[model samples]
Target: MKKILMSACFLGQKVRYDGQDSLLEHPLIQQWKEEGHIVPFCPEVAGGLPTPRHPAEITTRHPVMVVNLIGEDVTPQFLQGAELAVEKAKEVGACCALLKSRSPSCGNRETYNGNFDGTLVPGSGVTAAELQRHGIPVFNERELDQLVEFMTMQEADVA
Candidate 1:
């Protein structure tokens, strides 16, 4: 069975910056849980950020700066977490990653624009980018079905 690297918050774990879980109660996730193919992780927490952490975002793309709402730079921690996440994915032989959207560490397609003004832009988060760079495909929660399709193709190739 191919394992999946998942964002902890999607597993109903309170690992989000606000100490909340972005629970995704989907049947496919339930199936993966039953199959023991879920490797739950939170890059922000893994990088040494605390629960109820100051919400952060990518303030710059060139140097990839992650700054909290209070203007503190947390880029190093985010980078550390991203590295850890990639390692974990490799360790578990994860076929893909299902991450939280709009998160500084987990977003696969888009993250907060770092202005703290409720804007969004096209981009991948730190962890997501790392995972991708290592050849692990990343998916947001909204793309579960798409992930399933990709997984099917992977299995097909193996078979």
Candidate 2:
């Protein structure tokens, strides 16, 4: 079975910035759990940010930069977290990452627009982008159907 890297929150861990869990009820995730194919991780927390910490966002479209609501630049920490996540994926030989949606560290294709105004925009989070750069396909919880297709393709390639 292919190993999957996933957000810690999805696994019911209190790893979110707010120190709360975002447990997943999706069937695909449950299936993975039953099969023991999931590896849970949290980039932000792994990078040394505290629980109940300030939320951060990618503040630009180019030359990506992450910043907190208080106007503090957190790019280095985010990048470090992303790199660590990549290391975890490599260590486990993860075929993909199932990340939290709209998170600065885990969003796959859409994150907060950086205004602290609750607007969203198209862009993968630091860890998601880093994982993709390292050849791991990243998906949000909503993209389980698409992940099934990807897994099938991977299986075909292995065969």
Candidate 3:
């Protein structure tokens, strides 16, 4: 069976920056769980960041660089965690990742602006970028259908 990297919080794991789990309950996710396709991860937490840590956003005008919103310094911890996630994906032979959106380490195509202006812009999170760079397809919660279709096609090809 093929494996898939999934956001820990989405699987009801308490690993979000806010110390709360996203706890998304979806039929597809449940099915995947039964099939043992999920490899849960939280890059921010894996990087040794505490829950309820400082909320961060991409500020370097580039999504690839993660920095402190107020201080503008690189977040080495987050980067480390993202790298860990990529490593985990590779170890598991996961071809795709399902990540939480609007997160500093898991956002796929949109993240929050650091200005607290309630603005969302196109970007990829640290972990998302690492996975993409390593040839893993990343998707947000909204893209579950697409993920299912893609995974199904890959499974068929394998068969």
Candidate 4:
């Protein structure tokens, strides 16, 4: 079975920056969990960030700078986490990724605009962008159905 690189919070793990879980309750996720196809990961925590840490956002798009609420540049941690995520994806042979939306590390298509005013902008998170650059298809939790379809196509091709 092809493994899926999934956000730890999506599987009810309290690895979010605020020490909470997003908990995706989709049937496909449940099925994959039962099938042992989920490889859970949290880029922030894996990159030496503690739980309940300060919320950060991508402040610079060109260089992918991440900064926290107090204006401390956390770009190195985010970048290290992204690199480790890509390594993990390759090590586990992940077919794709399902990440948390608006997360600095896992957001797939849109993330916070770095102003902390509840605004979203079109962009991939650090880890998500790295995964895509390494040829992994990334989907956010809202795109579970689409991910299922993509997995089905992948399976078909393999067969």
Q: Write the residue-wise lDDT of candidate 4 on 1-159 in tens digits.
A: 699999999899999888999999978789999999999999999888889999999998898899999999999999989999999999999999999988988998899999988899999999999999999999998887899899999899999
What TM-score should be assigned to candidate 1?
A: 0.97
Give candidate 1 regions above 4 Å deviation. none
C-alpha positional error of residue 8 in candidate 3 after TM-score superposition, expressed in Å: 0.3
How much is 129 displaced in model 4, in angstroms?
0.4
Model 1, 62-121: lDDT tens digits are: 889999989999999999999999999989899999999888888889988989999999
Candidate 4, poorest ten consecutive residues by summed lDDT: 139-148
Clashing pairs in 3: none
> How much lDDT does each candidate structure score?
0.92, 0.90, 0.84, 0.92
lDDT tens digits, residues 1-159, model 2? Answer: 789999999999998878899999888788888999999999998887888888898898578898998899988888889999999999989999999999998999899999999999998999999999988999898888898898889889999
Which 10 residues in a row give candidate 2 its minimum summed lDDT? 53-62
Q: Superposing all C-alpha atoms, what RMSD in Å does each candidate have to the true structure?
A: 0.8, 1.4, 1.8, 0.8
lDDT of 3 by residue, 1-159 (tens): 589999999988887766789987989889989999999999988887777666777775443556664565557777898899989999999989999988878999988876657799887878898899889999889998999898998899899
Better of 2 and 3 by lDDT: 2
Residue 34 C-alpha lDDT in model 1: 93
Residue pairs clashing in model 1 are none
Over the full model, what C-alpha lDDT does candidate 3 score relative to the true structure?
0.84
- Residue pairs clashing, model 4: none
TM-score of 2: 0.93
Cα shift from native, residue 50, model 4 (Å)? 0.5
